[model samples]
Target chain A: MPEQPDQSEQPDQSEQPDQSEQPDQSEQPNAAVEPGPGHRFAPDTEWRRVSPKYLVVEVIGSIITTAIIVAALLVAFSLWGLWWTPWAAGAVALIAVVAIAFEPRRVRSIGYRLREDDLLFRRGIMFQRQVAVPYGRMQLVDITRGPVARALGLADLKFVTAAAATAVTVPGIPEAEADRLRDELVALAESRRAGL
Target chain B: MSGAAPAKPAVDLADGEWHRLHPASPLLRGGLVFIAIAGFVIANLRERVVEFFLVIFAPGQLDDGFGEWSDENDWGRDPIGGIVANNLVGWALLAVLLVVVLVIVGFWLSWRMHTFRVTPEAVEVRSGILFRSHRSARLDRIQGINITRPVFARLFGAAKLEVQVAGQSGNMQLSYLGSSLTDGLRRDILRLASGARATTQSPAPAVALPSVAAGETLAEPLPGLAQPAGPAAAPGTGPATIGSRAGAIVGQRVDEFLAPELDPELAPPESVVHIPVGRIVGSTLLGGAALWMLALAGIVIVGVVSRQLWMLFTFVPAAIGIVSYFWSRITKSLRYSIAGTPDGVRVGYGLLSTANHTLPPGRIHAVEATQWVFWRPFGWWSVRINVAGQSVTSGAEAAQRTLVLPVGTAGDVQRVIALLLPEAAEGGPVAAQIGSGLTGRAGLDGDRFSITPKRGAWLHPFSWRRIGWAASDGIALLRRGSLVRRLVLVPLARMQSVALSAGPLRRGLGLAELRLHTVTGPVVPTLPIIEREAGDALFTHLAGEAVERANDDRSQHWGREAADA
Candidate 1:
């Protein structure tokens, strides 16, 4: 778990992007393209992956939801005197186990990068995406934590921009980290959008 | 709040005085409900009038329906006409007087409850009898000001001022002000907004005063109509100077404003573009609103000829309602004209209730130019842009507001395109090529872009070859349509997100549709059913282009001062 960087030093970082791997001449300052998983904007840039506790939350939620559905199905099967009822429960348990095993890897694929003037977040495995939101265009930044996430000390940071399609959500970061990132992004957005 | 207080001009509105709406406000706002009620009453009266005719002309028919009952009841036997003939007309007149009194009392009460106040920062309006509610819009966020005069309000020398702001769910409407006052207020606000920006840059002189030519034949000023004209209105209450020296000078030099005085005549207009009546009607008919009108007309005609007079009670009102609905829609855009000013794009249109829209630069999120299939022969097209914060007011009004041009020649399209997207049009392509690219018509310049495969024609039986897309250095253009040709131009900087989707059938044909998400407006921002490889390339290419140009300074600020800011 990487700590969210303090953005008070942004002015320094903005002036020193040239010192970080020649500033990638092929790429635009606003474009954040990732060919595959495990990508960052600069060589020194750190990619913040969601907390592993997110998987625990996911597994618990999955088990509880699956148990409720299976219990209901079991009641119906037994009340109707269906002998293969136990087999149905066993199948559901199997599916839940498989889902729990895959949860961590899926969570690992989601990562976000904070750049000098924009933020980039990439998610999905089969149909991968990388979206960049400029600080000047950001309208709102909201942080929300569900019961499961709250218990696990995690929150979701959502970046809202003028264009609905470009809004990005980075989920399962530690709560404190989420707050710090939100504050920094808000400040940056305010300064960048001053003239507007 | 008393009506006795003299009306204050909008110029002195900065003192934060809470002023009620022009006394005639209720007559315009609540008058609609009253008119509807009156319509019902007249409908009832019309039915009685028809019955009276039947009683007089066809006594035998009347006897079959109500004569037996009339004979059984003495009071009913006389009817109202017989009573009047018997010299009981005074009683009838008293009853009518009582009803009129009740209506007047209603209008008065509604009028008394509504009030509005204007401050330098925001405009606040409050109205509610039981459940009081207040709404206000900050001056900084306001996108435009529209002055509207409905047919009835016009007769009373009143107009409605609608303050449109970015992101607010509803427009802040102040109704029933004098027409000239509303115009003066619009100029005042725009000037103020522009003046505020000038503090940070060089001051540009205000353009020539809005020409009265457009409003002359249309009853420019019903001056005498405003019985209580404000005290300060005699000399025009709006700020007359380009830059007032009333404010305290801070760090910047006062002399800097005096330098670089460009020719005001050479400067582009603050606002001007009008949609002619022919185009307004043409575009509406072409968009299928005409079909609805035709179907309604047929029903009304058939019902009347078949002696189903009851249909007048039913379909005639409905027909009139529909007709008025479309009539209002067409007329609302009748004289559509947009002017480019430092504050924003000031749009004015409408025959009876003209609307003036001030679209500040940077407020517009996306721009798209489209031509329907029917419009192809005439080489006419309509342009619409998406701005932040407008609540989608049904599809029709949304289409209306976003219209940069209701109907325009190809040359007009190019001019508007250039005005809206100077960066994209700068030395990129000729106006004709842009027009052809927009219409998806392959004459000489359309082939400059990539066209869909001949197999893609299977998807668009009506327009296969015409479906194509081209990417310029700063913008991406997608043209699609057969009967209704549409050209969507996405400024790379404004592209929010890009997506590609393919149904099973499209996948089978190795084709997919690419969609670029833009702000809410009339344009759909899509490249429908192109080759799968092309879709992928477009998606990736646009994403990159959008990012590259994300910081492109396209604000409408002018001069070296504008550059510094």
Candidate 2:
């Protein structure tokens, strides 16, 4: 009989994946942790939110989208002949410009603090909600980056749980910060388990 | 996936595409759509067209005369008007042709714009016609990957691949690849993301595990239930070993009866749901409705035959019925084929279009069973799995065809749960302590402490049914409310990362909730169950030690003897 690669047999094998300083190992570095109040994030650590070139990308994308809509309208009118309306495109463009200008900061205002024991994620500047997941309850600490995240030199940290909402997300931070946070969280989670 | 091939990992299987039925599909369909629009437009414009033509004929703004001409006939006008209307049709035809050409071009452009690429590290999706939108996610970030094969796509050999990575995904994307490629890609992606070896070291593959004793051929429905072979096994949670032939027949029956129903929204022909007569009225109604519709259809056929010599294909009703019968036959043949080993489980279903899924223990997120009123007489039930990253919800096409059943029989539920999530599957001695309503000490094992508010009595109302909760590094316990039951299984390792918080009302009540989070595997799922303070404390103490070794880097090289380590 072939061995099934017993992860539980050597509980340690399940602990190995989380090592990465710059090695973008696919996702956030998640490590198991013991359950306790001690798993909170370090109080002093502050998340220096990345400027979100990606946010700007989204806005620029909207602009490009508006432009395309306008160009499409022009071609469409050239063929269909606009009888009842003429300023429709202008009105839409104006509305889009307004929504794009100030929506980004409020859009990506996610904050994270890697305290000694827990991971604190505060997001939505206006409707700011502080979510503190202890390192022990922290099921898996993951670091993920996409093409946009990569371009902005940022990464997303996800805190998964068994609760109905298994995933808590913190986005738009420097890749280095994401790495440190992931490692620290994983290590903390591991330590909690070790105490058990 | 474990032994199919070495260099190449298993990929997701894609749903196929059907020949176009949508207005925007094939050239013929597009043309028909345009014709319909044109016909409606021409029908409404007839009167205006006649007036416009009369204007061309009279020239000197004979408004009243033109109106009079319009009143006489909608589309026809004296000579000049006729010419203009004909010219208008000509222009409209040409314009429609131009539009048809543009639509085709647009479709091709969009397909290209939404192209996606998969690499070892990340999956990149680039979309947009004008503004460039590029999306990429690390392989590990992909929380779950759902692969579906719809019947239409099956016909076309083009399946849609829906990759659900954590963080907001814009929308489900249709992967360009079909069956083989989709499967290959899914396999490789999961292998890389899960941190499992993409290329297995073994030259020989592992033998397929059976749900029964060794030497059993996998050809049919599992025979009778496996005798409760051991004492520790939970009551009713016995192994059901199926023989190869029995397994095949049962599987075929499920494919025939249940597969079609998988897409519940699809109205089978005659609006009839044929079920065994002895079953509930829900099943009986199906039969009566079918017979009644058949009689009515026959009458209509007789009437149609009387109209001009017999038109063959005009029997659309009969055609639909034929197809519906095939669909029903296929459903009766389908059954959920499941086999459980300590390592993992293999679940298979469907007939011609089959889906086989495998998930090892420790990867399952949550499992639940549900029963509808209609199922009362049928003795049937449906099960659901919430694997952290995977959402069984499929696209419109494939959702109709995918297998929701991982295993049949309620008995397999707990064991399957054990196969997927080991922590929650076990029962502990703490039942007595909690039963006595241990005010401040909710858990019996002394692993954790939780206060028993009036809510504690509701924890295990009926023998073991609740939302299971597991602390990250604490004691795992089960909990339930008059309205809800949450069973938590806290591994000592999970207790290390604990957090406590309270909202406005909860704070007033001196009640705070603690959250435990951790993630792993292709499933890389996490669990955080809420408890009134002391319950949280007890779990913390019980499960804390397991987290310690999990943190040590030295233990990391313990299991990779066959791989890189």
Candidate 3:
């Protein structure tokens, strides 16, 4: 676990969200297109910055894994005539380096968007996935920050649904945005409460 | 608290149910972590010479210890086998290590796989770090939430949630959620479920049977309802402590007799319907006697084959048989009570496996009761319900829900019918089907016979004799039969799936049997509409177009109170 200060310590950190900081999709002209009858703009916006600590965690994990493999292989080679030990060690070391180098980029790419009725999260490199959690079925939203995420001024927002096993996670999102989204979900959930 | 003035007071179904973190989620994580660590430990120790010998050469390695240990405690191996085993020890350790890693990784993934978000409207199932999959179940569509905290999970405080759906096997679930989240999800979904009927139109008024509240409804206590101010029962007056000396004695003795293993009773305090100790002891003794006899016979066989005059040799099988018997009996030791009120019914069974399953009057597909030939003399009939989306087995030591009434006569069955399902007992599709089938002596005759055929009908006066099934004779044409002469019924409501079955042989004869799936029983884990599944499926398909078309069957009035048993 990262031993670092959480985002709540930020001097400018805001909890009570102002509506002025609305989604800016200025890059897409089609975004302005009106909803015909049943259609609504996809509820969420594009990705935003993720917690910076994710980079360090990913790199460290990959490096430790690499070191273990290299040490084991060297021992095996010396003792049990392990074949191609040097080459395997080299290949694994190269992977660890690549993973470490790209860690920062992957961390930056993690972000979530809030749509009118669904929440979407976008992550991954070559194969990016977009998840949508519908509003009507929304149960509760929790904003949690692990030690590493806490150091990076980021939080993970989770959307829980009633289905026994479906929870969507928007990980490494900006703490401020995470709180705003949590508020929005709570408001909408309360508003949608069935009539007494 | 008056019923009338509160015009739709609470969000009916919405208000009653709640969700909290499954209490054991963290324990589950810890368990997973332990298993992973255990794997690592195994990996670390796997390559060592002495441990390697322990694994393969040791008798304890085999699941049943046949290849590993000598029956005569002669564990020595040939000189060549020992040396070869030593030479390959390093490779074996490496392989075991690799296996351990894979197992650890798989468990972590599985733990990750079962993560969930439960709400009032629906439950969400999500898994996979790379190639993720997600499934959600609407509250109304969910028959019941079957939860099983496996032995490992129990240690970790984690449990799996499986929802039994209408006309489906294993609808969906989440795993290893902390208890709080699981409870929260259940509550939220049940809340949303309570709102389901309201969604189609206006919500139906939820009937909260007062008696069913704690047990049947699985009351969430509004988060602030403290424990009953004081134990109303005097300090010494509690019926019997489950883990107490007596309970443990009962648990252990039952375990030795082929009973289902006794996990402690898990249903919330309210749902506990206690049975007298005498009944438990009596049934167990009877079952245990039968098993002991079987073990004796096995010993005789073993002795005859070996020609050895050994008293100690027979001990193993006899002990094993006793253990197996205890496990079976403990698992299926049947005891239950139906807490009924005007609103609904809460059926709790098995002191240890007590699960209080409540069905709103609206969600019931059907109810059925049948008596095996042995039960006829004593009038012991078992009742089952066709619940839409009801859970079959959730891995909770007990099954989700089955209302086995107190062993009663036909008259008592009638009263229970009146209390639990007044309309069905008075004559709905359930009552009519049961009534007509019982008195009508109707059956479809084909070229086959049942397990207890009409010929064995009188063999033992106390046995559950087959009623009127004669494969060749057309006299009981009202009923239906094939090789499996099972009877069934389907309410127009809980009809989600329907199909027809005709085996290769049956197809040649140009005959088809309609199979209707109902929610009931852990055995085969289903309720099939033996004779009418096909026709029902086809008609229901069109009825589904309108959705509300079949619900009209609820009002179908028929007088079935006196329908033949």
**Top model by TM-score, which number?**
1
Given the true complex, what DockQ would model 3 score? 0.01
Off by over 4 Å in 2: A1-116, A119-132, A135-196, B1-86, B112-114, B170-172, B196-410, B422-477, B481-533, B542-565
DockQ of each: 0.14, 0.10, 0.01
How good is the docking of model 3, by CAPRI class?
A: incorrect
Model 3: residues with Cα > 4 Å off, grouped in runs: A1-196, B1-115, B118-121, B148-160, B167-170, B176-187, B196-328, B331-368, B373-379, B385-422, B425-565
Tens digit of per-residue lDDT, candidate 3, span B1-565: 2443253333222233332334445346455676688679656545443444565587465243223433333425332234333465567558869986876676566554545554444666676667787776755455555444454544333445556455434477555553222333343344345432233222213333222232212223311122232233223445423224344443333332222221112223332234454544444444425557666777777777788658546477767777676554544435545554222344544434323344434455544455444344443444455554334554533333543443444454555555544444544444433444432332333312222333222322222232222111001111332222223334433333222444433333332333333234332212212222333343233223212223222211111111111
TM, every model: 0.66, 0.44, 0.39
lDDT of 2 by residue, B38-152 (tens): 6896687677666665565766765664333333354443533444434564675477689878877866666555556555456776766988887777654454444444454
lDDT of 3 by residue, A1-196 (tens): 1122322322221222212223433334454432311233333344455566667656665777799999998898899887899789999898788777777777676665554434445565533333444443456788888766677787778776433223457776678878986887786545332110
- On DockQ, the leading prediction is 1
Question: Residue B271 in candidate 3 has what lDDT?
Answer: 25
How accurate locally is residue B229 in candidate 3, as Cα lDDT from 0 to 100?
24
Error of 1 at B140 (Å): 2.5
Q: Which candidate, 1 or 2, would have the higher lDDT against the true structure? A: 1
